[model samples]
Target: MSHENAKQQDLARATTDERAPMSTNQGQPVGDDQNSLKAGGRGPTLLEDFLLREKLQHFDHERIPERVVHARGAAAHGFFEVYDDSLSEFTTAQVLTDPSLKTPVFVRFSTVAGSRGSADTARDVRGFAVKMYTPQGNWDLVGNNIPVFFIQDAIKFPDLIHAAKAEPHNEIPQAATAHDTFWDFISLTPEAMHMIMWVMSDRAIPRSYALMDGFGVHTFRLVNAEGVAHFVKYHWKPKHGAHSLVWDEALKLAGADPDFHRKDLWESIEAGNCPEWELAVQIFDEATAAQFDFDILDATKIVPEDLVPLRRVGRMVLDRNPDNFFAETEQVAFMTTNIVPGMDFTEDPLLQGRNFSYLDTQLSRLGSPNFSELPINRPLACVANHQRDAHMRHTINKGRVAYAPASLDGHDPAATGAADGFHSHAVALEGRKLRERSPSFADHYGQAKLFWNSQTAVERAHIAKALSFELSKVATREVRVRMLDHLQQINPVLAAQVGRALGETAGDSAAAVPPSAASDKADEIAIFASAVSPTSASGRLQSTRGLSLLDGSQPASAAGRKVAVLAAPGSDASQILSLRSALSCAGAQAMVVGPHLGPLTGEIAAMATFANSSSVLFDAVFVPGGAPGVQQLTEIGEARRFLDEAYRHGKPIGVLAEGRALLAATQLGTLSGLTATAASGSSGSPAATLEAQGVLIADGSDVATAVDRFVATLARHRFPDRPLAAQIAA
Candidate 1:
């Protein structure tokens, strides 16, 4: 079999027993599996009920230990293919340079702090771990959605997770980091300021797993066939561009639907809307690294895109959902040490520690050194090794010799020479074994300020509001004040905004602290104080590229977006059907929502109801024209709130003919995008009107024109600048 079919064949063999007759582990026929072996109906169960004991025992031990972090996850099966062989000059990794090969991959997306049962929409880091089954071996690129981390060294990883997790004394807040313990830790760790800015920004609450970017967070090395190495950073850019949920939508989604992200991924794949991302890398040599002021080894820092642009290497598409969640997604294991010959580890302290910790963690979680034997984790490459069996061992080695260099077996499994086997890059090193951090990692506020300065005005306001909201949850006043001091170092204006929200002034005695006390050292600041200036030392745009979500460089598409069409009894079925057909042709789903489930009209049926679904769940709202239906909708409270809430959240809304009555009945006064004219007196064909503010209105005859204009507005996602002075509470 070819490399592509090898793993599929193994999985087929393992799952062949599915849908067979029910049986015990020993393959005995199970006639009464549901009731178990029992005594008389009125009497106590017999002690000889072996079937009952077996079922209960298996059920009790079914669940393995969830991960210490990133326990909540969803996964898919996919394939990764390179765009061309352009990267071959920099690395001998065939996975990145082989355009003809489609390497099989399994990707798991997750939230960092949540447990197995936590909601998927928490404001936290998202894990984007990928395991590629290559011809040479499996390569696991375990990363997060954000480009940076809260701490620089892996030694402080435990402390970071402990502080971010729920408080231990009472376990008060479930998956949130807004409590006192988290802010207390963050207030003291000055080095975490850069990552803090990212976490508190809109990037923390992604709109969807398929709409966010992924980063490897640490620098590594790419070695070519000649043993030459170059420092590299890995990135995964979504094909449709990165987007995020507003804070209000994220909070409402947590209570309304905990599995929002997981459902979205599964449905998208089933609907033939596969999620795609381009695998890009930032490649540079040692000379380039030395020219930078900040340390590339620091995990909390980012190498700005303007400094080193990304080179698109390959593309990955997730087209298949898992068959069994436990057998595949939950049991899959990924380790950072699983690299091929072309890739080697850098001296990044955090990466070095992770290379050791990942392997150790699997030993405890999977309960065996034989986790590699599992079908999901198994590589397509042939296995010929001297290692013997352990717990859960699936392989049966032949012959009497289990040790290497054996004479009895005629040295059958000898090692390949360096030319064909894995080789680490040879780099000269001279350093004392000390516990001190490099001085290059000291200037943390420079990048924090860079991020704050890169945002658009609206994005900046959102970040300020997020910081105020998170800090307001902390009960300890000192922790909030200390954080304000650190923020003052990053940007005084930001500090003042958050302080005003907290009912304190930024430079007050309770919050003011010397610059030296706020940072590692007062002199360290002078090293990179000009880093965030409009122009860098290289005369490049220093703060704008690849930082903001609304940069307009990212492409927009209408695929996979959902729109809700409101309907009621005696609704205009023809208008609804025409609009639905137009949206369907544009690759968007149009769901008819009514006051209750079932038929809303003779030809139209409600797929969703106002009571079960909220405005926050859809990308936009549409109201069809029908005097009776519009009157009925005007009497419904949910129908009225639906329009009000959609307008308040800046979502696009479309109304037709009599449907304008329902839109007008809401408290949204003087809609900016309304374009109305008398249907009978209009001389020319009525055309849909769309303003910069995302709202559309049209007569009943212009369904096609209205849909085209409405989709264009939906592609823009939202209008954050819409005037909300007349907005009413939903």
Candidate 2:
């Protein structure tokens, strides 16, 4: 097992231990929390009270600066193993060449705009950054869920983030970009169109971290031992297949469980269903780069899989969660510039700027350049860099030589020769320095059109809905119209829908917004990439053959899953026992929630043992048929709320006979109308029952088959098209 997995198992086990209840920082057990310590019940609190001061001080310091962007994230530990070092023609990286070697890795997944406290189910791009500690050095693949980015240049990065984050003046919204600032920026920046389509699709709201893909946004250069460089784009394809939640389901989840993504990551790792992704790259020489229509430096485009297929070089499995959330997950630092010896940077201006900025960001965030010394961020390789000393500096250089030189340290003071030292590709620079964008870095709509055309019908609908919602929030009519005009360039139907939502027409008006570009800076406004008319606005609406969630998710078995049976307080205990046994046979845990919290009665050994496992604790919940239990819970508020929240979160709702009535009594019966379109035989309309949206209802004659259908529904994550209320109950 990987070191990370072992650590996670230990952490998972630690949760079972009781660490003492509500104590002061000094370890004094508090008798009451409603009021602060005082001389008397009404007397003023004494200033000498150390416990109160300590408590308040600790509470005050509870937060750190969330990330400027990509603040919300989850992390896991893993290792990378290379396949064949056939890339000796391009990269001389030792880890890639040595098949027997393993590189320890840490990965953090995030959403670009949300704060650390934001909801996890937002429809936004995800950040997938991996830090691999190779023998030579640490290589961090800082990437995003979408293969492309919103802008081509890093100078525009601040602008993109500022726009996507909550709008200024009114901070009413959090972790969502359904406002004018984001659309206004993207509509003007044609390069953003391609990424915009993806953000609006179901892919942005992934079912879990295990079910999505990651991409290194910029094209980087890999140099071989011979110093020959080849451009490459990194990709991480999930073995479970790409998946997402329906827009409505995502919204419901925001309210049901804001930490949905993080929880999923922790639970999956602990359950022994660790997630894995294949690290691959699209490699091409200068000749191929020149042959492509778009500039190789452009971050907003991709070399379609049809053109240059990804070469699987290594695999990464995240089998463990962090032991300390603050130390490991929070303090883990990732940089785009953390490259190995053979991997080199391109003239790509965005990549160029990022190489310099990351160091500064890390220093400011981690409080020291010695951040490399942090346990989570520390590299496995030996380090002798001369750089040292800052706040919280932990290292003590053994030698007097702080700079790279010969003198005091004798034979070795650090640094190496051309054969052993890090080398940068020696490329000639002939062009005059300029402030303008390269002419070739235009034509944003082609790929945007390609992405739009690549999506399924459900995808396009989500896109349209997302655009409409974002535009609807624009306070300025002109800003709305301007955004629509740019979107119109990409697709008239999309622009028209957004325009209608904003009550305006698409046009080039003086709709410039301040705080992005300098107020005095002349806006040389021109539609750089004239958007192509969408071939058919609906785009591709069918899931790629292997993309369906129910058909694609992993494990394919119930191990740590929870099955809840709403049994009667004093009814047939045997029936419930039989039910629990069946579930246990399938490797599932079963809990019975009776009319009351105390022990209940039933007849014979058939009566099952029950525990009060709240719906919150289960991956999936079941409703076993019991006339008394079903009748009792159907009329109760907490029970209804429990089912409601579960359905809203896209968990499966299994009913046995009368369990269906209890479900219908709440607003869930409407889900029964929707059956799943199955794989085959008595399929009982698996697709209809689950509908790939947010709700799934089983109406098959057999209860076990219905349970199987419900289990499959749980695998899918959410039922997409059903009403929000119905989806939650089912």
Candidate 3:
């Protein structure tokens, strides 16, 4: 359609909708919404204009206070059901054991320190909290991407948060740990070593929430039908395979698209590719817990998956996105105490504190005791409770006898019996009133070393480079030294490598955070570090089966991916036809790039046209052997920018004919694997050239092969070992 016709259509649609007229609050008709009531159009408006005042007043208060932590979160609504009612042997939670039951669930995924406005691609711990509304009650499994936490004790949470957030003096850096304050705190707290190593690794910056693995950071108790108490940890394995963006890619994505993660999620759901996760648990008896080297209650550690494999219990699939982001996603509350009968809490200090903290925080933030009455927070089960009346109370009480014990009032809602009621496991407490860190919680380096050992070489290199980049940004020498010391405690080589990356020496590391001390349960440390091969790449991922991302999720295909085909105003007609058909057969979306978004007036015309889309928007690019159009591509900055951006984004490129010559002339053509060969026909144009498998050059302008190769490259997202150094030198 022409621009003029499009504008006319828009005007006509606007005119059709105008019949209803625009109205304001209180049913008042507005003469204008674009401009306020001004004294003389452009002059200052009078304060007496009530409509403008109301509009501005409402607009000013449009945003509510964001969460103090995890303010940035993406939410989805879903339903969960157990694979079997076999859990009856474990607990009396009817929902867990009832095969006919289906529970409603709301899940929120977030970044810890970032504000709601922060970049989605920042290197930070991701929060994965799920609210399961069961027949018994609401149960919230609040967790993080990494299994461990920064601090052992809950008392230091405030200080830890403050350091991780912006500096107190200026509050300059937002949602990032690349500052002096964070390093200073981490250097001071040895317990924080394990978590620090993780955040510096690739796991912290996952490709999407769909690809991240979530863990309930604290160990909890799962009581069976026989009232047998077992210590357990919950985990959510993504139905999509685990994957992460490169650190360099993440950084660029932050600037290029701050809403990258959010948009990806929204689009995925809109495309009917719903996200899913499998709920699993690591169960161990009380006797088993007593056998571990480190304290199971310590939040800053994980019972390695090898110790207890995840036993799948249920599956949660988020097939629907919320209708309203605020009411459903934002207002939905998750409380640690909202567990069913079968599930019970543990004395993991941080978990205990969080159970208390979440309710208080929600009370202050939501301004209500009745927050559970909110539609999103409300359970699918019948809610019969005595708790009522504070902040927007939506419920109506029936009886005049509000007090419990009454002769006439039959509705005395107290505990009926232990059979159907929420029951706590009969575990005795024997601790005296005292404040101290457990001797078992002090072994910080053991698991830190284990995590380091588990990583692949690429993962380790990424971590080392990340540490160097983050520490290098720390202007304070002492802070850098402190971080260096922590890294040294993790691994000497890691520390030394980062030191070289940051141009520092180990001797200068700030006095080893109150001086490293020995742990009481040092024997526990030995168990984790025993006879483990550190260099094995197979163990780094969840599975050794190819580490293929196409697993768990959809199959490999580039049907919807846009492919750019470069041809001139006067290129081969039959070539375009055969090439387009081949690409179309491959399920790729092809667009012809000629002089402009204009038609390709070549010999055999086709349905080929262009839009204003840059190369950055496409999955791959193809430069058909059109030497005539090569000048148009190179001369145009947007066109060249297309090639450059694609290179940086790591998309595939295919060039042929004089197209290769044009690439060689410009910076884009000299990229790795761009080897030129002779064209098949006697056109004297080079075509049968091997660029990269991703970047293909056909045998004498065999457009079909270039299209086939483009599809293949899209399948392989990136080429990590590209000979970029050689290409740059050329």
Candidate 4:
């Protein structure tokens, strides 16, 4: 363990012993805590049992209303610092321009559709909301893992959420969108096709909150000191680079560790592997924006990186976990309108709706119009305003002057001029009072096709598999076919692949025709899909490498990875220690797992046992060699099964000397073309040999070389190229 983890362990142990006497809510000492006060020790309880009354009363109201969305979340405290003041040329936001000031930030990551108690590993949109307390004010860049949203207009948000959430009839499904209602709504909403592609991709199921990318979703305006405005989109590129769990791994993790992503984030920070993201902005002037085929203000579209490159301005590092989950993570409110003077909202319908919706929802959920007074939401800059108190108001506004423009207080707390205070961009507005979408927002499937074309072969396969799985769960055949029609509009190949999985005919558009029950919804879908010719899609860039997670831009490193070292009685302490040391040196975590906890002979401590840990919890597994250890592990069913399951999941495995016998015992060893480098006489470099098959084998020689090669193989995360049959049962 590292020094940071040691300190964390100490802190955890320190909290085990209660130091203070138990007391009531009023600090009154409690004489009896176990049993409620009763008459004659068995008779009816009396009203004088103040302790019981207080306990039950508090318990009754202990839980507050969870968020309407993003209820399940994890949060951390951090600081943001700029690389330079170059951003000043684009915007006057001090947080982006000042390199000397480290702005304090609280970031909350969440699953959008899940309740507060839902599993963290659910395949749902992950919310990436950041509240930065700059010198100017609190700026909240509320975003998500995917850049686009399902709906283009904020008015349709309620409908979108209603469809994505559990069906209202019985609420059978929880924290999942694979149901009739969701697909039914999705099929009718053509504007959502682009976002659907993203949701079905592996990005929806992130490996960890620290590894996924975040985007501000809506395009906004950044005003400079000269009163010039530029369209901007915020992006947070993870230093570890974007990565995700395979669908099978994700499914198993939801059961094995419901708090998997949350625990991963908290533990990574505790282990001193603070997650970092570079804050970049895609800035384009009015002329540049006009050059784009589609509207720049469309929330469901993305500006290809090839057209306008990202400007890296600053970086954020989350180094501290929240002291209290509810006090910090739950109560923290992120409003889209909470931007500083330099930043302003665009006319994107979804964004305009969100600006009002966020504040309105916070008022009801936080039980206060004064939620900003909460520590996590409070601005670092001094607040001076004429606004009065409401429920849960913490500040006692002194003096009688509560309104501005009054002579009594010399117009104190008065608004400043455009140079200092917020000034809306001077873009002229002239429009009739009508409910209509802009003609510019008509093309929807173009970007969806672009996203499809951008994916690597492996990613495309995953997306197809995901779509197949989700549609398979839709009980309504009409809903499934309707969705296939939309998918065909985006990519005919994708629709055909998914169609095959549903046991339906391929290449025939008639087969995708909605059933008679869905006829009523057809006209609505046609209105959106038929209005535009989708000509803009042809002019759009063919593909952008940035859109793919498997592209060469993503960094491949072992840092922050967790490895489980399978061990048992008479385990080779030397080999385990060397491998653990190597992993730690690469900034990864290594834990020894055995049949039981505590000493596994010598200095090697069994951090977790088979009974308590599962292979799903770790990124990789290593089996250390020892004659006795191998024999013991062979007898332990879970120990032997662990390797088999790990192999089936495509996780990298390392085996030494006698440990090879344990591997040979599993079905993995019997697979055709399986090669154990230690036993194979073919002369080749160890890196090439091990990496080719994601399996490293070694005898009792060259311990350092073997461990180094094993660690390298583990860094690759997964070897999809390995020739292993999918039909092989673990």
Candidate 5:
């Protein structure tokens, strides 16, 4: 049977309802689920109570050993469809080249260093692992949010992970790399500088999983029917555009809502606002690659778009949230070696190491080589393997002939020719057994500087602040100085700003009063500085497309954004309804937040209460006009705090006629005074003086006009550099 039919059959067998009658593991109906069978309902449980025994046994083994890395993650079920058959020219992989095929896929997004209980908003690399049950077989495109990795070779992966994780001696910090040990490792590894710039930038703190880009960090080979091979790098460009949260917002979210990213994904999918990304490929040949200054096999570099542009080939849309978190999301396994016929691995050391590591990890954590038999990990294609299962073996082999090419079974399961089966690309290989890295992978600072130069001014500022904050957390002064020395090689201005923030100089060991100690410190800095060449291909390219989240080409749609509409008992009924409807029409969720829950006025009800909600939860705020409502809102301390906090965070606020009084009364308004208002007309009518200041104001009589302006302003997201925003109290 075809993979599509297999997928349909699997979906049909999956449980659709959780309200079914309760039963034991053996499907025996249970009469009592609240209490276990006991001697007299208050005595020790009877040994004959199979239901109690089964339940307790299952509960005892419910928790599996979590993954060493990427322990915390959110997953979804989706389908991938190619845009056209143009990709077929490069590879024969049906999933990437067949426009008519709807390949079922499961994607998991995760943080690299965090444990199972870490905060979702922590600054770290995000894992973007996609498992596609293709027609031929399963293909797992395991990748991360960043295009480059910290190290060039996979041999250092353990060391890198060890240093980034909690200190082994004390296990002091969890899910963060700000401590001294992490810096100590990073300061010594010059190859880590390129990736360090990324982890310390805003990209580490994404606004939502839906808004970040995903990359296949290593270059792989795409083989066509003609046996021609091309080097390819895979990219997943978010359809909504790559965006990230402000540093302050990310920090607050970690404390206020630890599951912020996971919740955002689940709620958006449930609400029918599915997230999407376009699959793009940068395909090049050996000749083209030879002209590049850096090696394609290096994991610490990226092939800039300016050199080889990305070709948009397909799109993946995640429309369904997982039915069961543990059964589906947690149990699903992704292996780098699970590739189809037309795709083959490159000689990239990191890639080769991952090809082995991922499978080993699954075997260790899933507790069996038969992990592939699990429903979530099972392939949609038919299985005809001769090998039998080990632990957790669910499959029952009917025939006695387990071995292949048996005369007794008429050699029925004989292998097919190369053309009819999966084949690795035939490439000439030459190398002696060695433990040294290639010279081409030596230049690390070039790409580090390139990433720094590609960011917008505000983005660069955030990067500097992040570096300062992380380094400041390191108790060791030498670690901070060493990191600064590397940063100086990447960007002197950035290094200077971070050094000033830390109140220390890059190469100055003034605190080391002893001459010999200071000389030793200076020598270490010089060694790090000499390791990486500053002028390379990546640096010469200047800036590239798709690096900055605030670029002008990014989408300005308000779809999927959450807006908080603050209302009170006396809020204008028409104004409230009109604003909510307008926001809904824009595909944004406008939730009514009031002093209390339930009914607020005629035909108006509150969905969230001030005591239980904060402005940080929403993207923007809208206050409807009414004399009594404005008075009530101003009297509530939470309401004032919400407005003030929102303003301080640079969120746009819209106030109508009487509602304008509430804004003027807040501490935020006092800093800049209530701005001027414009004459009201229709939605098209603008010229509101306060609109320039990111505050849309209108007379109570023109509620429709004001709401239109407000929704429009909300679509633009936060207005960061407005004059009023500048005056708000920090």
Candidate 6:
């Protein structure tokens, strides 16, 4: 049959009955779909069964190779809109300058160094890649949650990933860097010091994809209509502000729900609480960049926000989830080279390497040069080119003249000249073709120290504990000591804190020596010594304002927060309903967790059960008044444990009237503000009794005031200053 006849028949079948019969790939209807063709009931199958052969063959090749990094990901469909034409003077790109056009976008959030089956809560760098289908073309802003990367040069990427991945000998630990190989590489690569500070901090374990900031790690150039070029760095600031999960919470969530981040993103969008981020850029000129002590081309560094404040230009809202995971999220490709007309690349070695690597990766992973023809990847702009006839080609050419510059077709599909189309920025180049790194990229520990100095006391402690936990897993003593020496360079206090946990001392003579002790050991130690010694030219800001997660600049709002309302038989249904209603009004969610998934006392249905829920999953916990319900909850071990865990994690806790009995049953009774006897004053107003420890108690009558105070406390996220030493295991 001719191709046209096959196409017509397929279209005719599409207009048939609603419940059509299943057909083969070739449109042949299958009658015996339940079983493969066989000679007899217990006989051997024959090779002549084309139906069985075709089905089995296709099933055998269902999966494509996963990415080497960022193998696990979740994606959503979205639109990006420029706030105004403010960026027009800097860039001629329509997507960045046109306020009326809502450019369609598909964004994929992923976990780096993890396989497709890895847990989402792993303490790893998160990939935040956005592919925008603009009128000009498809522009992919591939980046990560962390602003700075581990390595400055792209050639070291493979080595970095290989070391970070599970050890090849046993592959015992999956999706984790708390191992010997990773630390060994990091300890040797002094350039990773700054990134190590970030990965060890709470930033690595983000509370949710929507709560973390995204960054275009490498600096690029923005070219205007007048042919002026400026250095630019992109940032995606979450509208709700960046937040992170505690280490204990992250560890528990990894086992409780491997898809925690993915589920949160999907549900948030579905509930109409769409995730939004403001697109900001730090624009600078070549002269301004030259003044910075650190090299602007270094991927391992960041231009302090104070040095060059960000300019908010637009916003991106992910309002829709993908229809299919594999078709859109898994197969979608993002290349660093994908930029619009007004964008151009820099000579940053890491950025330069990514430009070549990303395209090659797509070719290898997608198994075809025509992968761009995939519906998820195809740009909205009209495509006109002489290139054709690759594997899986979708477009058909009309004229016989497929080649360019042919008079027979009037030189059709010609390239647009510089003024009308994409043009490279005019950058003069002068450099030798020798393998060398820029000296300006040195002083690796200065910014690392700056990060250490910027963090709050609690944040610094958390960083120390995280580093201790990771290094404790490294069985090799030399690697641990070497890492300690590097940490000492960042901060003596930080080094001492981690060293105490490791039962070793930082700056010891043994640790100062190179671990390998090669013939060039003296030279290696000298290099480390020189790299760590801070100089006036290190560009080290004593303290960066936004480096800490607890910075006062974060928006304190209860929106999108989740509170678990504990309920039992004979619980105060009115108070429960009132609290839920108030929390909903505040843009928060209140899920009633009971012993069983059914109506409890007063016909109040439970949305979650104690057995299926844990306090680590919630931002706060609340208990309502009722003698029988309070007594019942006091007796239930999980109920008591839930309250205990919530208190131990520094989450907000609220109790009213008889509900204090349940609080007394847990170890939280020993805490200063959360004691059962603390509410004896009989104050009806929750605000009057609000504790700095994040505990609220009041008489059951003032449900409105109680919810208001609770929501306000919950907005603070956590009271880390609470005495955790008094906490007991739940």
> In order, what is each prediction's RMSD in angstroms?
7.9, 10.4, 8.2, 7.6, 8.3, 7.3
Model 3 global lDDT (CA atoms, 0 to 1): 0.70
lDDT of 1 by residue, 1-730 (tens): 8985676555433322576666668876665554544567567877787777887899999999999998999999999999999888888989988899999999999999989999999999999999999988999999999989888888988898899999999987888999999999999899999999999888999888989899989898888888889999999999888888888889888988889899999998999889999999999998998988689999988889888998888899999999989878888999999999799988888888888888888898999999999899999988877788889999998988887666685764565555856898887899998999899999879889889878766677677778999999999999999999998888776787677679877874423333442233232222223235677687644585888897687777767778889999977888888878877776778899998999889789999898899888887899989889988998998997888888777788888878877776766633433223334433332222334457676766777787687788777777765555234576
Clashes of each: 0, 31, 9, 0, 0, 0
| TM-score, per-candidate, Cα-based | 0.91, 0.76, 0.78, 0.90, 0.90, 0.91
Kindly list the per-residue Cα lDDT of model 2 for residues 1-730, writing each as its tens digit: 9997676555533321365455665666755543566889799999987767887898897766668988889999988888877767778888777778878889999987888888999888898999999998899999888878788888999998888888778875688887778767876787787787777777788867877888998899888877889899888988656666666667767876788889878977887777888888889999988977688898887777656877888889888789888888889888887888988888888888788888888887877778889998887888766787778788887867677666674756464665765788998888887888887887877777676555544455567677778767777677776767677776665565455456665553323222222122121111112233434365522112222233333335454355666666544465456556666665455666665555665542212322333454455666665567667767766666556666665566666555555556555544444311223434445334443443444444465566556655554544433445433433
Candidate 2 structure, TM-score to reference: 0.76
Model 3 Cα lDDT, one tens digit per residue, 480-592: 87777777777766776677667776654323312221121132123222344533464432212222232234244554345776666555555566666876665455677
Misplaced by over 4 Å in model 1 are 1-17, 39-44, 412-418, 508-533, 536-541, 670-690
Q: Candidates' lDDT values, in order?
A: 0.83, 0.69, 0.70, 0.83, 0.82, 0.85
Candidate 2 or 3, higher TM-score? 3
- Which stretches in model 2 have alpha-carbon errors above 4 Å? 1-64, 84-89, 412-418, 504-621, 633-653, 663-730
What is the alpha-carbon lDDT for the whole of candidate 4?
A: 0.83
Give the lDDT of residue 194 in candidate 1.
95
Candidates ranked by lDDT: 6, 4, 1, 5, 3, 2
Give residue 91's lDDT in candidate 6 (0 to 100). Answer: 92
The Cα RMSD in angstroms, rounded to one decimal, for candidate 5 relative to the true structure is 8.3
Pitting candidate 5 against candidate 6, the one with the higher lDDT is 6
lDDT of 4 by residue, 1-730 (tens): 9997676555533321366666788987765565777888679998999989998998997788898899999999999999999889888888888899999999999999989889998999999999999898999999999999888899999998899899898986999998988899998999999999999998998989999999999999998999889999989999878888888788889888999999999999999999999998899999999888889889999998888898888899999999888889988999998899888888899898898999999888888889999988889898988889788789999888986667685664465554687878888899899999899999989889878878766677778789999999988888888888888888766676677679764457434434431233332133223222323545647567589886567887888999999988798999988988899899998999998889987899898999988888998889988889888987887887788778767788888888877776666665543333344445454424544678777786888998998888877777653445264465
lDDT of 6 by residue, 1-730 (tens): 9997677566545522457776777988865554666789788888888878888899998899999999999999999999999888989999999999999999999999889999999999999999999999999999999999999999999999999999999986899999999999999999999999999999999999999999999999999999999999999999988999988889999888899999999998898888999999999999999988789899988898878998999999999999888889988989898999999999999999999999999999999999999999999998987787979899988888876566685664564454658989888999888998989999798788877777766677778779989999999999999999998888765676577678897875445444442234233223223222222354456676678888578888777888999998899998888888888887789999999998998869889998898998888999999888888898899998998888777889998878877877776664434444443344533223346578777767788888788888888888765554235676
